[model samples]
Target: MLMTGGEGRMARIHCKITPLSVYLVVLAMYSTLMMLACLENEELNRVAREQKQKTAAPLQDDMAIVRDRRSQHGKWLRTVDDFFKRMGTLETTCSKMVSLGGTYCRRALDNNKVVCLDEDVTLKSTNCTVYSFGIGADTTFDDQMSHYGCDVFMFDPTVNQETIVSTNLKNERFHLLGLDIFRYNRTHMNEYPDGKKENVTGEFDTYDNIRRRLGHESRHVHYLKMDIENTEWRVLPNLVEGGRLEGVRQLAIEIHTMDIITAPAHQVLPLLRQYWQVLERLTRLGFLRAWYRPNLVLETLYYVPGENRTIATCFEVLYLRRGPVY
Candidate 1:
């Protein structure tokens, strides 16, 4: 089976060319497969983008409806994600701050009320008038103010009494009235100690009516303090709307954010917007936030859905009316 030199050279060439031809054919198949894969990926990406756009259209429409409703109400609404942060922030600056009452200043539990006394002469005068609301069982603040010769009028509906009681302080400058400040004039039902039924009835009146009744319609209230649990959210709006706060020089109030914090995720935005509107209205009324402290006793931390960290549910804020002494 021995072949000639020319024949052997031809056979060797055939063997090499066979493998090279097979390699070229396999290379072509691989290139085509890769091209098909690239095209398939591009198609998938295009379809995904289209699907996303279709989904976003409905969301945009819903937002438009929200915008329309906001416009109808004539309110500039804020998103819920940043509501707590904005609320916790101090909006104004106070040069001089004085803490009165309680055991200590800035204590977590039963902290002293912070007041701005920058160039303020009303609170130090003997003719100063103070209206203190929500006087549960503590009158330390009223007592201290009375020590300054300021007339302190205290109001509360849950004092286990049905009628208004007037008490004279040691300095004869304090008056206690069992009444509640509310948006409207109504009868507040006082519950029994056993929480069985509300058998006692107390009067709740608006700030305007109360001031008129006390003949303080034209008199300036040098200092006003309120700690009406969660009713402040309602009472404050009424006072601002009725222009009853125009004669007040300083306000120390506790604001509760529990409503927004405890609401369902879907309803959080509306509640936060309402809360923001209240603060915004106060700001518009020239109420500058001088100082704020968290109520550490009822400090509950909740992880809001859109917020990264937990937020405090309650805070005591001091707002000083900026402008004239009145």
Candidate 2:
């Protein structure tokens, strides 16, 4: 009987010890997990700090430069960067613009000789120059532009398969010509996708020829609008290279396809990076104080070896050149 009681005591002590061992194991595991969690949090914080520093270093550097010396106010730099960054968000804002929105700011051209969308008709007197492949009679350019006290020059090398000259028109001040801004007359037009039956004469010319033929000895252009399909990538470089591009005061243009058209000259963009680059170049030449892209055209050009396929696609931008508020 004593031996049996001794066995009971041993079993009781083992049960107590077993529970204590389990408690120790659980505590050790919990401590290990807490340590791992702290390590992960530290790594995450490190990565976030690196990213923040990378992102903010430039701004801080600009601040340092401003502190070093300055001509403009401190607020000006921030405002300019913020404005452009916000403007960069407008990549495709005009890709689907249907009409003048009720909240649209077309009045940006107010208090000037040139007026944009829904322009006021009171002070109608100025010369208008439109650069396009061609302007059909259906465009508001002829009647309205002439009536607005402006002599209109429609510049193009009308290349249609048929009766492009039928679209050709002229008046006392409204003239149509087959011409373009080119380099030493090294200009030529591509064949139309439709057919040769309606093809017109040479639709391409150099900037030198365009100004010499149309400038009437004056190098100034009151207004300019270019819609030469996707040729802007190639043509814009030449325009900017010459001192002649500064002749314009008001500008509007249709920049055509980029998605299906890989402009070897302008690089391939699914959006408007290159177009904006060209505009920025012009703006630096004292062209526009500000500009806006308010419309988009649905058209694209597709090239498939011998089987050439072109589609209708383009984007439009209107710019107001620098001038007095009056």
Tally clashes: model 1. 0
The lDDT, on a scale of 0 to 1, for candidate 2 is: 0.45
lDDT of each: 0.64, 0.45
Give the residue spans of candidate 1 off by over 4 A.
Answer: 1-81, 103-107, 120-122, 160-200, 298-300, 305-309, 323-326
Q: Give the poorly placed runs of model 2, Cα more than 4 Å off.
A: 1-114, 117-133, 159-197, 259-276, 289-298, 301-313, 323-326
Task: Pick out the ten consecutive residues of candidate 2 with the lowest summed lDDT.
Answer: 92-101
TM-score for every candidate vs. truth? 0.63, 0.46
Candidate 2 TM-score, true structure as reference: 0.46
Clash counts for all predictions: 0, 25
Give the deviation of candidate 1 from the true structure as CA RMSD: 19.8
